[model samples]
Target: MEPLPAAVTAILLDIEGTTTPITFVKDILFPYIQDNVEEYLQKHWHEEECQDDVRQLKLQAEKDSGQKGFVPIPSNTEAELQVIKGVAANVLWQMSLDRKTTALKQLQGHMWRSAYASGKVKGEVYDDVVPALKKWKGAGMKLYIFSSGSVEAQKLLFGYSIEGDLLELFHGHFDTTVGSKVESDSYRRIADKIGCSTENILFLTDIIKEAEAAREAGVHVAIAVRPGNAALTDEEKSEYHLITSFDQLPLQSTH
Candidate 1:
């Protein structure tokens, strides 16, 4: 694939694996959530949004397991039930399985917000991210973010970055609300929001499924493999434009 042109009006980027390292989320963010889930739910139970999500989780759990009510896990005790309000905690724990659950991610943001404000955590961005973002923005490309992470957490991550408030670089944010990044529909939704043809938008991510989805939607795609991360397979290597460094790409405007 050719390098992006200055004429490409919008730039859509992935968060966790592209602009940020996968390790940071896997090692730092998920663990933080696991450690704090019980406490966060207890403290925030009174809030309407929290209560609503908890209710939804209960319903979702029933739907997922085809059970009439909250199915007791191996460790469902009165104390554990109290932590998540009976059925909700089990649902929350189940959400942690592949780390794909929206409820888990939402709960995680609540925890991380506290962590960031208390100076216990800061967001990590790739070394290439800031400079490349600055260069693109300076050249008049409209930048946007799409991640599985909730928009609130996305803001928190960028707002509390080691470089401080890199949120200025993005004009918009999106999460699974539109659709999962692995779905072609997500790219189509994002394209509509950005007021650009999919072909005119460039989507960067480290996950092949997401890149494949974007490519299927007619967007340009690049696979980012960060340092100390698992390498893409031979099939993936054959299928996508793979890069270890942002600098390796022809980033400058060719137009």
Candidate 2:
């Protein structure tokens, strides 16, 4: 906690559950998709991406459910489509049902973009986020975002943030295209893209696997502890640097 330890150069952050509350995404935003999926599909089915994604989801459902000819079962009946609704209940299912990050992002973008447009939602950032970002930027620390959410969705969240356009605070953004955050290769790709050695970059996230992957890539790691998440045991907690608040960060400046 001593003035960010001096070794850190660039900062990579996760969106949901780190800078933003996990409840915002899991409870509010995710449920919005569940509630609107039928209406959304009915209206958007003719769109090429929607058609492609639905077809892919069907295949995924079949694979997951272990049925032959696993392409999405034709939902000629409302009951059949209703069953599909059950399958979509798990977001992890949704991600696995369609391996295409583009499709996942497109759907998320449609949801959040509409939510933002209709005033149904505005993005939230932790109290520590804005001033800390400004402070870090002022201290010449470069910033980037790495999230499972699409980069377009990432932009919208920050762009329409409650703090009013926090997107300007970041130097770059990356998403599942590089591979999921759980994989060490993702951090390596990010490090290469940013043109820096991994040791100089710091990754902050609420998920331990992500921090572990960053650590594997030689980046310094910090775990953000937001409320209502599963508490880590002492052994689990010992593996990484932990931060309970943005102000807890060892920033050099005394704002």
Indicate which candidate wins on TM-score: 1
**Candidate 2 lDDT over residue span 1-255, tens digit each:** 476656678999998888999888767776677677666666666788667766655555555555332334445455755644543443344543444444455566776787777777788889888998988888888999999888887888888888888877899999998998999989989999999888878899999888888899888898999886658779869877788887678755322
Which 10 consecutive positions of candidate 2 have the poorest summed lDDT? 67-76
TM-score (all chains, Cα) for each model: 0.80, 0.78
Model 2 stretches astray by more than 4 angstroms: 41-105, 252-255
Model 2 accuracy (lDDT, Cα) = 0.76
Candidate 1, residue 153: how far the Cα is off, in Å: 1.9
Local distance difference test, each candidate: 0.76, 0.76
Candidate 1 Cα deviation (angstroms), residue 24: 1.8
Give one digit per residue, the lDDT tens place, for model 1 in 2-72: 56654466778888778888888878877776666667777776789777666555555655675334344
